[model samples]
Structures are given as structure tokens and as C-alpha cells.
Target: MNNLGRNLALWVSIIVMLLLLVDVFQPGNTQHAAQQLAYSDFITDVDTGRVRSVVMQNQNVSGTLTDGTAFETFAPQDPSLVSRLTGKGVEVVAKPLDQEGSPLLRYFLNALPIILMVGIWLFMMRQMQGGGGRGAMGFGKSRAKMLTEKQGRVTFEDVAGIDEAKGELQEIVDFLKDPQKFTRLGGKIPKGVLLVGPPGTGKTLLARAIAGEANVPFFTISGSDFVEMFVGVGASRVRDMFEQGKKAAPCIIFIDEIDAVGRHRGAGLGGGNDEREQTLNQMLVEMDGFESNEGVILIAATNRPDVLDPALLRPGRFDRQVVVSNPDVGGREKILRVHMRKVPLASDVDPRIIARGTPGFSGADLANLVNEAALAAARLGKRTVSMREFEDAKDKVLMGAERRSLVMNEEEKKRTAYHEAGHAITAVLVPESEPIHKATIIPRGRALGMVMRLPEGDRLSMSKKNCIAHLVVAMGGRVAEEVVYGKDNICNGAMGDIQMATRVARSMVTEWGMSDKVGMIAYANDDQGGGGMFFGGAAKNFSEHTAMEIDSEIKRLIDEAYDQARNYLHDHVDELHRLAEALLEYETLSGEDIRQIMRGQPIERVEVDETTPVNRRSSVPQVSGPEIVQPGDKPENDKDEGGEVHPVPQPG
Candidate 1:
């Protein structure tokens, strides 16, 4: 029934019940207010012929007095009593005890409780089944959403970046719309296409766009929907999903995060006899069984293609593997512009500069960057998102939120300035290192100082020279600490720097084959293992002595990089001191400022009083003359008293 009719029926039934209660009980408000009389007086009145009329039912009696007032009292349920009332010259009558409503209400009230209970039971059943009458069964039904024509609003124009992957899928979209174009030529279209990429690279968005372009029914589901706790439920779901797709005929079934169920069986628990495996087996059967699934294009996305079952990737199944990698610089610019279209951005906010600054950002990351910039602008009570806010947002995304509330002592601040100055100076001196983008002494995230380097362009691969130069620049912080504060007074500011340098050294020795002892061979677990990507796969194939040689080689590389850093800093001590002083005075410096300083003047090797600058510059730097060490030579007067240029302990 409609809601209003149902409600009206309910209220009418309730009113009928209330009326029945009133008719049966006959509340005192509807009875006459009469003078009190004893049973003997009632009998006297009845016998004296003073009563006009009387009625009796069971043990109750009702009569009207001579004055036309009605009265009621208890009496025996007897026919004799009524006869006596009739013979006393009084009119007698029966009460007929029926209520004043229609008889249908009686029947409806009796059946109303049953109807309400049945309706509630049905509602609970439908809820447990899933929803509506269609889900009246258990969880065997497919959960794939079937979007009809014009349902999905996302088109190809909405997605930017990952053009190669888009190009690969465009043909799939075309085939979905006109399948006979390829079928008449005996060319079988691929039933399944796998989109492989990292998270947030628009894999799912691209799938939706394809659905929009095809103008057909779109079925979207995740792989987890196929797997259930029950043994056969998953397999039944898979069959049902395929059945749905087939009924929809010209439809696109996009399975997101297919890896959840597509993992390699027998690799983990249950020994390939789990519900997921059964689901996968049923999926394989329905996908490429005896009958060909025509016009039901299946597309799935995953980040980890390594663990997928081989059967899922075979020729007739997932024939095409389109990789949706992070976009390059140009693609990033396009994505930024696409996201910025909705927000009011200032003219100074150039997508090119933002893209250049963000080299490794995916499409989602760029979108988030734009959102963060807008949020920053809004937080500052600004209407337009400016480049300054974008830059700050990028810094926040990369380094972390600014720790403006953190307080630092003067000594700590001075140490942070020198540490940052060392990084900037090394970056400027080292030829292979990328240019220093910005240097700051203000605390951000967990670091006390920061030196951000922006590469001229994205580097797909790093050279060994560049790697070593990075190491040298990384050690510059500790190198300066040792140069100014002496080895005993160096703090733990270079803990992160040391860790990065060690990792590079290890990678060079184990994976990159840069170690002299390792030759042109990779000893990494990735190169040797049949093991999983996450779980440490295999032990390196080498003797204990060879392992010792590898460790020694790593230490030696670090030592050499550190020596190079120390030599560079020793020669440019005057520049290092000036830069540190400038940093102390400004508390920050931009890339342009560093470049200007580098181009402005060469620092003369002249001594200054420790108390002269008031910026707390270290007093250890002294140059005898203008002569300094070249690339292959070492300084003469910087060695220790032992006359041995031994390896020094880096900070932390």
C-alpha cells in the first residue's frame, strides 16, 4: 500500500479498537449520575412497580427509576429476575451487548496484529538478505554496480596524465561500442585487460572514463566482492557476476583492486584450497570457458602484479597489461592545470614551475597539492591561491608541516645554521650534485635544518659519479661539524645524513655493482631470489670472507666520500664561514640568493675575530695563503697531530 493509505488504515484500526474498548467497558463518564440505592431498595422498587424498564445480562442489572433516571446494580443471572420485573407492571428489555462500530473493524483488528508482525518479519528478512525483494536470498548475489547509459559522468577529458595507458584502453572503448568491426574479420577481442599501476595514478578514473565513452552499461566491482567467508559463496558470486555481465551484453565490468583475490595460490595459508581460490577458479571458467563472452569487456586494476596468478594473465584472459605509471614533467603540468581549473588561482601560480618542483608527484598527488594550496589560501583568508601558498604547500607535503612552535637554544640554532650552510656550500661546489633549491634553519618536521635540492629535470637513472657526489654533499653537514666544532664537540645533527650515505654505499655495493670487489655483479636479494617482493627473499650468494670484503668496500667508499667533502669544505672555509654567517643573520636563504652569493665574490682567506661578527661563527678556520687543494691533492696543514689521515666518526 502507499504510505498515506497504510497510515490511514493503521490509525482507523487504532480508533476502532479504542471505540470497542469504550463500548465494552462503558466508562462511567457515559453513565448517569444517580442517587445511591441498596440491593434491597432496588428489589423494593422493582416489586413496588416504581421501575419503568429493566435490563439484565449475566450478574449485572440496569433499570430506569420512576423519575426517568437510569440505575444499574449487580443481580443474579436468572430468567426469574427478569420475569419478576416484567410482571411488576414494568417494561423490560435486553441490552444486546454489541458495540456501535461496523463488523468489519472487528475482523480487521483481529488480523491487524498478524499483518503488522508479518510486515516486520518480511522487512527484517529483506534486510538480512541484502536489501529489497531482489536481495531476499543469502550473500550469493553479485555486488557489481551496473551503470546504464549516461550514468557515469566521467569522460576522457576529466582524466589527465598517463596518456600511454589511456591510449592503450581507447581501443577497448571503441571495440565495446562497435564489436562487429573486429568480429567479422575473425579477430577475437581481448575479454580482459589489466591496468597495473601504483595507487592514486587514476586507474579507476580511467576505467570510469572508458565506461562513459562507450555509452554502454558499466559494471563496477572490486575483487574482494567475489571472495566470501563461506566456501561456495565466492564461487557463486563470481558466476552470478559473470551472468550479470552477460545479460547486460554490451557492458564494461571494471574490477578495482583485483589483487585482493588474484594473489598466487599456495603461496600462503590454506594450500590453494581457500574460498578465494574457488572464486578464482570459477572466474577463470566463466571468463574463458567453452562459450566466448562477447561484448562483455572486463578490465581490472592492481598495483602489485607480481603476486597475480599466471592463469589470470594468460592470452585469452587478461591479454593486455597497461601500465599506469606516474606522469612525467609535462604530464604533471597538464594534471595541475586540470585540477586548478576549479579553484581561483593567481596568475603567478605557474603550473610549469610547480610541476618542475614536483618531479615524482602522481596525478592524485598533484590534485592534493592543488587542494592543499587552496586550503592554505583559505586558511590565510585569501580568495585566490597564489604561488607562495603553492610553494608552502609543496614544502609541507614533502618535508612536513612547519614546526613553528618548536623552540631552540642559541647554540642549537647556530649549529643548525652551520649544518644547513654546509649542505648548500657542498651542493654549490660539487659539479654532479643537483642545484640547491632552498636552505633554511627553521625547524620543520623532525629536522632542525633543511637543504632542498631541485634537479633541472627528472633523472630516470643516476650515474655513479652523481651518487658519489650526493654522498659527498650528504656528508658536508658532518664535515663542517668536525671542521668547526672539532671532532669531540660535533653533535648528532647528521644522523639522517649518515643514514642516507650508508644506504647509498650499501646499494652501490650490493645492487648497483659499483664496488671494486663485487665487480660487475649484483648481490641484491631482488636479483637472486625466487622469494616474494616484501618478504626478504634469498640470502646473498657469497662466502663470509667476501661478505667482509663487501662491508670493507662500503666503509671505504663512505670514507672516500667524506674525505672529498672535508677537502672541499677545507678549501672553501672562508665561503663556508660567510654563508653560515648569512644564514645566521637571515635564518633562511633561497636558491637565487645562494646563486647570487656564489657569483658575487670569492672569500679572501683572511682571519676575523671570533667576537667581531656576533653571529657565533666558529674560530677554527685559518688559511696560510691563497693556495688550496685541487681535486687530486690534499691540504697540508689540516691533518691531525698523529700525521695519519684516519677515518673519522661521522655525527650520529
Candidate 2:
């Protein structure tokens, strides 16, 4: 029954029961106003002819007196009592004495509490079981959901940017389609396939594509689904899930984020989790144990394959491990095409150009880029998404949304303008440094102004010259401020630059072995074990004296870069002033504009909106610019720091 019906029935039954209980306890009319009399007094009244009428039912006797009074009494078991009442001309009535009461009613009243208790217990059990026969108290049942053909069907065609991983899984699809072909050659399909990669790389999507191509049943679940607070529940669930897979042979069972339960056994703090370990053990047995699961394929995905137990990744279990890395330039272009199919694009929108602009982006990130562009176009009441919108969206994703409402005084604005101009000029002059793409004093995210520099193409590794050039470019902003506003007048806008420079210098000294004094020795700590402060961190790999050398080398690198940057700015002081003035006038300058200003030519500015500054002849014409660096009130030394304008951190 529905909940409302069940509740109504229960309330009705309870009301009946309460009434029955009240009736059984108080067996007479509560509203009666009758006085009690002694047996002798009742006899005297009947004998004196004062009794008007009498009614008797077993031991209870009630009657009215002749003087207009009402009374009730119990008489002794005497035969003459009735005869005396008749001789005195008194009316007498007798009712059948239900001696043992109703046997059925009495039985019902006696067993009501036990009956209600049993009914409530059964109801609770049904609720805990999720009102399904397969749900055994809801804890031991498999939470894996069966994905049917009609429900959000995804095929290999829908997946892109991970062709190698897709090709590896295609064999599984073939095996499921025609198992006899593989069997004829005495080939056994992989029992389990583990997809290892960073998040948003489309591991789970690949699994769904496998199911779609094979046209087989897909049962999807999560690793955490197998675990619960209660001990042994996870194991039972594992067993049940495999049993379900067995019932639907030639099916794909996807467990996303398997590392949750498949982490190395007994390697955590306070011993370990008994429930999770037990669950993992049961899963291992089900995968490649004595009972062969021939037609069922297990697919699991996790970013942290390092922490997974060795047993889980052995030859028998997870026979194939596919690495789904970030898409390269070609793959990214293909991925952009896949996501672009759903959006309305203008004539100017070029997927290839957009792909080239976004480096280190995953499939999910590309999808979000397209969505953000569509949203921006829609917000502007445009019919289709344009290249300009795509560029704006990319900027928003990389840097952050613009904070145009922010207010800054003239002094701070001029300081920010010079600081960013310093970064742009240095980057342009340095041979190995990347070309300056844009420079701006407009606020974005947390920065007050920034100068953005984009590489000519994708760079896999950096040379020693390139590294030193980066350090010089990092210190340019601080040097510019110092030269323009005196030694003590420089603000704290270079903190981010300093931090970035220091990290690069330390890595060069300790990790990359670029320091001559360190002599090509590796002293960096390995974080693959996932150890940190809570895990007591890793021990120092190098001795105390070696560590001192490393710190001294890092400081030396920074000092040299700062001096070099200061010299460059001092020599080209006129170009720096011109760029800073152009930024202050236009509020933003593209690469072409910066070049025009450097050559003593006026830039043709086209204002598209309140916040966007467009250069018609620019090579890159989007609203994309540099990171915003806030000029802090604090004073610092003649060194650089950092801000959001450096390298963008790719979101997973």
C-alpha cells in the first residue's frame, strides 16, 4: 500500500485498540448516576414494596425506587429474592450472563500488543530493504545500477582526445561481441581493466563507450558503495555485485574511483580500516579466483593508482592498465571539435585556434570552455558563439572573471602600469624568454595589473638559458618600480614573481642538478607515497651541509637574475616609459599594440564593450590579457615575487 493508506490503516487500528483497551478496563457506563445500597437495605426496600422495577444481569442489579429515586446493588444468591420481588408486585427483568465473555474478542484484545509489535517490525524491515526483494536489509545488496540502452547512451564516437586508451578497450568490445573468435585462438580476454589518469581525463567515459559499442548490459557503481560503517557489509556487497554480474553475463561492471577501497592494505594510520580491506579482498577473489568469471569484465578508474594495492594490479587481476594522459595539441583539437558540435558557432569561431590557445587542458576542461563561451554569447543576446566570446571565456577560465567594479586611485594605477610594463619589456628583450602577448592594468581576479606572455608553441622541456631568462623576466616588474619610484618607493606587487623565481631556482639546484657546486646530485623528496605533515613527512634525503649549499645556490641564482633585469630596464628606460604610458591611456594593450607603441607608432583602439579593449590589427584579438597583480602597501627589497600573471594552473 501507499504510505498514506498504510498510515491511515495504522491510525485506525490504533484507535480501535485504544478504545477496546479502555472498554475492557472500565466495563460500565461512565455517565450513570446511581447510588450504592447494602444487600439488607435492598431486601427491606423490596419487602416494603418501595422498589418500582429491577433489572439483573449475572451479579449486577440495577433498579429505580418508587419515590422517584435511582439505586443499584448486588443481592445474595437466594431463591426467595425473586419470589419476594414478585409477591410485592415489583417488575423484574433478567439478562443472559455472558459468563466467559466472547472468546474471539477476548483473544484479540489479549494479543493486540504482540500483533502491533510484529507488524511494526515487519514494516521496519521492509523500509530498510528499500521495498525490493533484491535489497537484503539494504546493506548486503549491490548498489550498482544497470544502464539500459535508452538511458543516456554514449558510444565510442562520443569520446575523444584519448584515442590510444580507446583502442586498448576496443579489444574488450570485440571479445564481448564474439567470444568464440578469441576462444578459437586460445585467447582469454582481460578479466579487469584499470584506467589510470588525472581527473577529468575521461576514464569513466571510456568505460561507458565500451559498453555502448559492445551493446551489452552495463552495471555502474563506485568503490565507496562497497564500504559501510558496519563491519563485513562491504564484503557482502562485493559478493552480491559479482553475483549480479554473473547473472548478466557479457556485461561491463564499472567501479569509478576504485582507490577508495583498493588502497594498499594496512598502510594507513591507526592500523587500518577493517571494513575497506575486507571489501578489497572479496573483490580480488571475485576478479580472478578459482571460480572463473569468463564473460563478465570489470573496469575500474582512479587517478591515484600508486596507492592501490599491488594485488589489485597483479597479472591475474586488472590484466590491462591503460594510462589516459592529458591530450596533446592534435588530440585537443579533436576534443574541441567533439564539444563544439552541441553549440551554435559563428563564422569567425575557429576550433583549431581555440585548441592551440589552451594547453594542458583535459576533455572536461575543453567541454567547460565551450559551455562558458556559449553562456557568454547568450548573455550578450547573440545568436551564436563567436571567436571573441571563446577568447573571453578562455581568459575567464585561465585567469578569473573580471572585477571591473573595483576602484583604485591614480597613484596605485600608475604604479601598476609601470610594474606590468616592466615585465613586458624584459620578456620582449630577453632572447630565450617567451614573447609578451598582452599587458594590462585592469583588475582581474586578485591582481591590480598584469603582463601575459604566451609561448610560440608547446614546450615539453626548458633549457638552462630559458630557465635563466624566466628568472630575469620575473624580476623585471620589481626592477621597473625601483628605477621609476626610487629604491624605497617600490611596492609589494612583485611577491608572486619572487615566489615563482625562488621555486624555479630551488628546483634547479636540488632537483634538476643544474647547480655546479651540487655536482649533478638529486636531493629532492619524492611525494609519490602521499606522505605529508600528517604522515610525518619524508626524511631529508641530503645532509645538513648539502642543504646549506642548495639554499646558497638558490639565492645566488635570484641575485644574478635581479641584477640582469635591472640592467636591461636601465638601458631601455624610454621603451619602458612608452609602454607604461600606453597601458595607462588604453587600460590594456595587446601584443601588436605593445609592438606598435615600442616602434613609436600610435595603436588603433576599437572599444567593443565597457571592459574589453580590442586592437583591430592584433595577431591575438580576444579580450585575453595578463594576470592582475595588486600593489600592496608594504615595502620590500630590490627583488621580485609573483602573481596570477605567470603560468596558469589547469583545472581538472
Highest-TM-score candidate: 2
lDDT string for model 2 (122-235, tens) is 687766544544422466878899998786789999998899999999999999999998999999999999999988989989999999999999999998877766688789
Best by lDDT: 2
Q: Model 2, poorest ten-residue lDDT window?
A: 628-637
Model 1: lDDT of residue 261: 87
lDDT of 2 at 497: 87
- The lDDT, on a scale of 0 to 1, for candidate 1 is 0.73
lDDT of each: 0.73, 0.79
The parts of candidate 2 lying over 4 Å away from their true place are: 1-136, 268-272, 526-538, 606-644, 648-652
For candidate 2, the per-residue lDDT at 615 reads 26
TM-score of each: 0.74, 0.78
- Superpose all Cα atoms of candidate 1 onto the true structure and report the RMSD in Å to 1 decimal: 12.3
Off by over 4 Å in 1: 1-134, 148-152, 271-273, 525-540, 601-652
